[model samples]
Target chain A: MALRLTGYDEVMAQDLIQSTWITAVRRLESFEWKSTLKTWLIGILINVNREQIHKEQKKKETEQVREDTMISKSGTVSGYDIEQGLIQLPIGYRRVIILHDIEGYQHKEIGAILGIEEGTSKSQLFQARKALRNWLTDNSNEE
Target chain B: MKSKMNHEELTPEERAAFDELSNFKLPPASLEARVINELKNQGLIEKQKTMNIYLKWTASVAASVLIFFAGSYWGKQSIENSDIDPNLAYMLILHEDESFRPGDPMAMFEEYGNWMQDIIDRGIKITGHELDNEAVMVKASSETHFGEEATERTSGYFIVEAESREEALEIARKNPHVKYGGTIELKPYVVR
Candidate 1:
């Protein structure tokens, strides 16, 4: 889950996982046990990933813009695989799709985990699927 | 490829892709060791010391015998001196509420085990049991009710021998329950 959420950046995913475990241990006292332990850990991972993204955004703002333009112009992601296509998605779309589809979390659960409304989760899933489909189809045509 | 797929529905190809992604992948072998080491460094978990099998067995037997004799001697002394034992015993009532976050079950067990082991190593007589959710209340009028507030709230209890109330309070203060957002009620046993 951490790897998928971090666009398969192994180093970043490992860092996120390590941070998540430490945070979960330190903050275990605040856990109400209302949800399963797995959900709580995932919640912590998502938060850690969000923080990482925020920090990276400041450093890579110009680089991100250039990459976005290249992607738009090429009509396909740098790689043709579905996982690669997932990396090309906006963070919001990627998260929703990964959690809802790949992780098999319900919209309500996804909303609670992501701290978003159920409607928002549903809408993002729709948009994410559309985007992923378009990317995959365009890449297949290129092949 | 479906040209018009609803938000609620996944196309066959999408489902297959999702299935492929969902297939569990084992993380790096070193990650587990790294996590455990980090946890130990943070003092979140105890560093398990490796001991020789025969030596550990011998030590375990010696400790068991010592604890048994000590407990028996204390038990007899407490009974003979007075109805209320001279050695103060405090009941640590664990109350669980919304804030109590008992993280991983295995980790929680290990934590509690380490805590009780520490108390035992200090030569303090301690005993405890986790309470079950099932509880019933019987009124004086013979009316019985299930799930009383006290029974529902009280998750567990521990009785420990202490030299003084202050010492008992210190023990309670160190309990993982208190650290994990659970309330601990310390009460001295009274003789009727």
Candidate 2:
């Protein structure tokens, strides 16, 4: 449960939440009344995600090097319950959890965006949830 | 009989987990208002009408600049070549005189058409064909009738391409229509 507090917290949350606003503005024309406008905005965020991935790939290709792993120092903060251990899971599994659980995308929509079969999206989601639950259990035992 | 409780529903532990998960607040209200205002100002909503005017002016200025610079650049590149021969690649627009005759107008036109086909087939290189404003009005029959007489002095055009003006004239000499007594005018393309 990521909670709010101070300047550092605000800056970290900026990374997670900033793109939603820009996407809502850029894709105002494409908004249909099918789902909530927020969902449509999320659809645009998926496009932004694809663009970011493309830019990252281009950067990697140009540099011919892999980026370093990221770590946060405030691991034991009260709301930092995700068990920093879960961050070590493969990036694909992490992505599935973030897109599904945190971002609230459905399996079908996730499948469409990621260009995977719906069944594969479901399986990945299940595996990711199971892995996260296990990580939480293991960390709680340590605590 | 007493029934044993299964973990199908949230036990105390499950309830705590749910509460923890749902505790995170929605994004700040001020952030939402700021974002919506920014979106409105960005022309993503009601687009800026002034943009069309700005674009038109920009395009006109750009076109003018491009024309001036491109002409100067092209002139610089071609100056040496032009000195070697004043004409290289240029198009000529010619008006046909009203009174001129070939033996049979229709047959002569057919023969001229055949000549054009032969030139294409042989890959005798040329560029662009433009009918003069006056010549377009001159009937096909009139052109054929005029071709024999005026061809000795004038033609609808002398469209030629060569490394130099001299080469172009030499090429013109081989033209079936340019008779010994006929004239072919050479005009240089003056950059505007």
The TM-score leader among the candidates is 1
Least accurate 10 contiguous residues by lDDT in model 2 chain A: A58-67
Note the Cα lDDT for every prediction shown.
Answer: 0.62, 0.40
lDDT of 1 by residue, B56-108 (tens): 22122222222222121111111112222535778899887777765444344
Residue B108 of model 1, lDDT score: 47
After aligning candidate 1 to the native by TM-score, how far in Å is the CA of B46 from where it should be? 5.0
* Colliding residue pairs in candidate 1: A31-B101
Reference-based lDDT, residue B131, model 2: 27
Name the candidate that leads on lDDT. Answer: 1
How far residue B49's Cα lies from its native spot in candidate 2, in Å, is 5.8
For residues A61-134, write the lDDT of model 1, one tens digit per residue. 11231233223233333222567678768888888887877677889999999999999999988888887767
Ten contiguous residues with the weakest lDDT in model 1 chain B: B70-79
